[model samples]
Target: MRLSPSLFYTTNCEPALAFYEQCGLGRATILLRWGDNNMPVRTETMRAKIMHARFEGPGVLFHASDNDDAEPMKGSAMMLEFDDLGRMRRPFTRMSEGGRVTVPLARQVWGTSFGMLVDAFGVQWMFSCSNE
Candidate 1:
């Protein structure tokens, strides 16, 4: 079985998508916009909203969509493990834009470079790279 997380952004999916891409996450492989025959509810107001989108990066694959409920995103995080610190820097910096860093990227007692932050879209993330 394969498990993939789906991120729901009430009205800000487009910007969120762009943000992830800037953070070195791959571009959306598939993007479906709300249309006439897709959703059960009225599509007029949501025509511009994203019905679904998939992005794939080195060790991550997630779906993102726009929802009407506007639920708050909390208590979940995407952890990224990298073998090289140099390869992880750009993404770490980009993901921190306009967001608060809960843990600055630094060497940990566990012998890894680690950090945690919330992205501009409220997605929590943990980045780690081994010292080796």
Candidate 2:
């Protein structure tokens, strides 16, 4: 099968959706905070916290939610393998501009030039180019 939506759980769904929208993803569909018949108990606080959201852009559907407010998940990285380095470089640089770079884009041990960047929102991404 092909790619579907990728979901992330956040404590603040509204802000997260706004961030993604700023990143060029379009409007997100937020789950009803109240008045929806399918809501779970004790989840009224999250009625506005994005029970679920959908963002469509760049040919993929991206989803996220404010499902949990406990502790932040750590060491989670998302790898976006690109076929066109030309198309990817700009967006990748923009997203990681104010963030951290764990590995600068350069020839790597795996025979590819790859870089690791953590975006402003703390999402880690690995960008790479295979021998072509």
Candidate 3:
């Protein structure tokens, strides 16, 4: 079975899809907004919203969608682990260039490099490079 990490955004599902695609993820699929699937969405405004998206990056599957209820936990964050630190330096740095850094990328007591940030949007994200 194939398993992927799924994330729920506040209401920026489309924008998030575009961002993830730019972040090396493949084309995402929207399950709800098709021509005729007939999976009644509660709100009409959400018709254009993304109900689900699947992306394959670095041999892993990542999923995303929008949380229409406005609940706090509906929109969660991610802490991505990378094996190639060299390949990550650029993207990680670029993601943090104009974002707020909750924790600078540095070696932790656990012997790995980790950092946290909240992007231009209010979404929180984390990145880590294993020292192994």
For model 1, the stretches where C-alpha displacement exceeds 4 angstroms are 36-44
Judged by lDDT, which candidate is best?
A: 1
Q: Tell how far residue 14 is off in model 3, in angstroms.
A: 1.3
Candidate 3, 1-132: lDDT as tens digits = 865677666677677666656666355654455223775676876776777667565555777777677444325566678786776566667666556888887778998888887765456778888954
Candidate 2, poorest ten consecutive residues by summed lDDT: 27-36
| Predicted candidate 1 versus true structure: per-residue lDDT over 1-132, tens digit per residue | 988999998778989988888877878888888873555444566786888899887677999988887676788888899998998888999899899899999999988999999988888899999855
TM-score top scorer: 1
Query: Whole-model Cα lDDT per candidate?
Result: 0.85, 0.63, 0.66
Candidate 2, position 125, lDDT: 75
TM-scores of the models, in the order given: 0.89, 0.67, 0.74
lDDT of 2 by residue, 6-57 (tens): 5555556566567656765456754554325766634656554555667666
Better candidate by TM-score, 2 or 3: 3
Candidate 1 clashes between residue pairs 3 or more apart in a chain or in different chains: none
What order do candidates take by TM-score, descending? 1, 3, 2
Q: Model 1 TM-score?
A: 0.89
